[model samples]
Target chain A: MISTTNESDPNPNESTLVEASPRRAWYRVDDFLAMGLAALIIVTATVSALLVRPPNIPQLVQDHQTSKVRLQQLDPSAESFSADRKKIIKQQAEIESSIATMPLKGWLVRPGEWKDDPRAAFVKSDKSIATPLLATFGVLLTLFAAVSFVQGQSAWRFALGFCGVFGLALFSYVLAGQEVVKHYNLEYALWAVLLGLLISNTIGTPKWLSQATRTEFYIKTGLVLLGAEVLFNKLLALGLPGVFVAWVVTPIVLVSTYLFGQYVLRIPSKSLNMVISADMSVCGVSAAVATAAACRAKKEELSLAIGLSLIFTVAMMVVQPFIVRASGMGEVIGGAWMGGTIDSTGAVAAAGELVGSVAKDVAATVKMIQNILIGVIAFAVAIYWVSFVEPRDDGSKPSVMEIWHRFPKFTLGFLLVSLILSVIQSQGIEGKSLVSSIVDGTTKSVREWMFCLAFVSIGLESNFREYRKMLASGKPVILYVCGQTLNLILSFLMAWLMFSKVFPNAASELLAK
Target chain B: MRFINTGVLKFACACAVVVAVWMLVLPVVGDFPSVRQRIEGNRAAGINPTAVFYTDHPAMADIERSIAAKVNAPTGSFWQFSARRPK
Candidate 1:
């Protein structure tokens, strides 16, 4: 049976049956174990990235520089200038290709895209993904079973349960890999949650399978791993104009939306309100997950927020570009607007591309800069919850010690990993390439699996009754609509001001590159 | 017969619906000319419209590199020179 030995929950049945309150102590044994494993993975990725040196990157950079000089010396109208430019482009591609990726690139594969045939996801061009899938299953089962053993649960039972959970997650990936689903950016998280919900709400989650549905553990670890990808150097992608458009406008929208939900809309669940607010205002699913954890939101609330975001993301992805073109909004401004407003990065890119290439670059860059807010927002929300929200709700002022105890310790791991990686990336081009390789090769795939598993666990844990309760007031939908409207107006204003009025040359300058 | 409970039948139906939508409905939607054009255009530009993060989009690497080079370039460099308009 699923159980926990944590002192906070003495009742074994309670541990298995009920979700723990967000008020539990910050440093549980399971949390520490998750953080420990995450740190180990980060360290492994880093060491591997540094050790696997690309050959003669410096020489390639020199060659590109020489070609650049030659192109510059030629007259602008000269035919040779165009030829030299093409050479420079080819040289740049070589430099990008030379960057060393993680050693486990092929071993950590997920399902590939498939059209018409489901089997194509697993096998393409005689290359079967069975080995990698089996390898992943084995590794995850062993690691999680070890965690169960450390927690004083039956590791054998946990292993048995893990196979079921892993299978569901694998199926979720295949469903998400459908070419049409992938085209619309219907990510695996949505599928994982839906599949889990279908099983749970229909036949109900079996007690045996419940043993391996450690949602919090998986999510915390994934968030920590996510920190490695949030390099601070990305904040400078569009320089000051990008920063003003993303960093400045985002907090205003987030805070304004939250306040509106609280005062005007009078949303009953502040945590739900915050999660929805963050999800709509910041970068979609990632933001919702972080905020939900930080504020200790109910699982149902997180699911609801994600559901709303995904629906809107699809609609916005299709409609926003049409509006941009119709309005005669310049590509840079339109791209920035979409990047700041759209919750998902992929949808933002797709929407921006519908406008123009210049728009796509600006949109993606704005979103990347905005993505860094997850760490800051999570940390702030955690502190706010512990300091004000908890005390007000409980009618007991938490002492400074109590506040510290209530704080989610996992946020610290997330910030620390981001800080360490950002410092590494800030070193030079080699450092940047190394960080990219680590993220692309190892951490990203692992983090995605963790999130998928967490979503599945959430679905298995959730009930229709809880969702009914969440939606009874109709406030979440209203809150999302109101918040998204605010986001659109504010983001468009900021984008226009930054990319047009404030830095009129920035758009044209970006386009030239 | 008793084993095929309401819940089990409902679950089976949900699975069938999911399969049908993925296999049938979505392909038709994707085949629309406007949708096809946008999808093709994005592919040509190396943009993954469904990318969840910046790193997931392969084009981002080139964009990031170009931005970094521009931001870190020396005074009067080729990057700056390229951005200038002809008189």
Candidate 2:
């Protein structure tokens, strides 16, 4: 017996040792860095929002995300179409009552009345401003150190690099706050991307910064938190009609778009085609990222998709309000159409607000319903890729474990949070409001910061040279334009049918309520 | 051209035909009288919604004034307008 105990001999003892070794407090560096940092942010934000009771400041009409110009475009009766006035009165009363419960109303930021309902009446106090900055700095420092440790590098160097990068992003956010920028829907995402591009193109990204330039890590973390915001109960607000428009029409458009890109456009990369299709058909940049990862698309493809999305989003945000006004479509139809077509949630909300209060509410709800499709779409794409697209060359199918290993696990995190929140919300308003407060107050802010950081990373890591190469053939652009055009037509048709014919009562019911 | 095999070409042609047909058919299906009536109803209302000036909320008014002041604050507006706009 020549070394019977050796692993080659398949000895039981050796096998046990081999299996146990990997289980012995072992973790992959990259995985640990991303997961640990993300977990830290999620935990801190959720806990902080719950524990730190900021004065129960009522939301102001002025704080509404819709611009004055867009609101002006709404039908005069839009203010009366739904319970806009009643809601405003009720909110004011609630705000006043909550203030009475507070020990001191003077020190707290007052919820100023909207001279006009749904408009901001006061300059929001900067009481919470310092808190966000301090929190951001602390979180950023810890995240950088952790990532550096995982990469087995100098922690302080990476931390310093992160600070500089984050400072750039912060400056972009400040610029985005300018009234003109807000008016034009030039959001911080766009500014962050521009800033990153400016640095990477001109001064060039420094080497040390590469340690913190993790686009996927930041995006995945944000996506997980974003999942928490996609409360399932919100989808039922539009009832069966919404389900038909958002759920049924969306898959049809998505499948057709992918096929169009693959067969008609003959895109060289299937993953690129898939990414473009998903981005166009579903919720734009977010859908594209999820789908790209599901189908294992390249970083370059995701960047291209996001760039196209932002360009179109800005155009849509500015133009769609006018279209809604000109077409004289009721708020329900306009909102649903905009919700389904617009890529970004914030952009959709902004466009809807431009349409009017009713449209804004409908658009936001429809977008939320559509947003939930990400989970299903990601799972389907991953399964399809594993089974058909990337079948083994040897004709052997992958094992379940193999496919599971390749699956984007962050999606699971997203689903878990959504389920937990959905269940909590189903109980009653108390549970619902609790979840909303935590998500809106804390997690959402953190998520936005992460998203901004992700875009910056996308910019820093992306080379214009590579992007040009991807766009050289013009196939991707053609794919996006054609697919989006199809999406616009299909979603509009479905919305009209569902809201106007199949469920006119549902639409009216929403207005009446 | 190298990747454009017979099957892919056929698939593409089929998809093109399907898209064409759908494009032709969608408007007809979507142009229900009910939808048109709703839109027309809104148009016929003869009232164009205007922006709320928030005259009641002086604070809100103040906020707007501040934002306007910030945006319209002239660093070199005259020079920039002449150079950029060339009016």
Task: Give the CAPRI class of candidate 2.
Answer: incorrect
Clashes of 1: 0
Query: Which candidate number has the best lDDT?
Result: 1
The lDDT of model 2 is 0.58
Docking class of 1: acceptable
lDDT of 1 by residue, A1-513 (tens): 243323322232321211333443334365577788888777777788667766677886676567556544655456574465546656765665576557876677788777677889998558998998788778677777787776666787778778888889999989988767877878888999999999998887887777778888888888888889887867877877788888998999899999999999998889989999999999999999989988888778888898999999999998999999999988888998999999998889888888887788788889999999888999999899888987545697879987877778788889998999899888755676678778888888888888888889888888888888878888999988988998899889988876666656566656554
Instruction: Evaluate every candidate with DockQ and list the scores.
Output: 0.39, 0.02
The TM-score of candidate 1 is 0.90
- Compute each candidate's TM-score over C-alphas: 0.90, 0.69
Itemize residue pairs with steric clashes in candidate 1. Answer: none
Candidate with best DockQ: 1
What is the C-alpha lDDT profile of model 1 across B16-85, one tens digit per residue? 9998988888778878887678767877877765566677787887766555544433322322332363
Error of 1 at A496 (Å): 1.1
What overall lDDT, based on C-alpha atoms, would model 1 receive against the true structure? 0.79
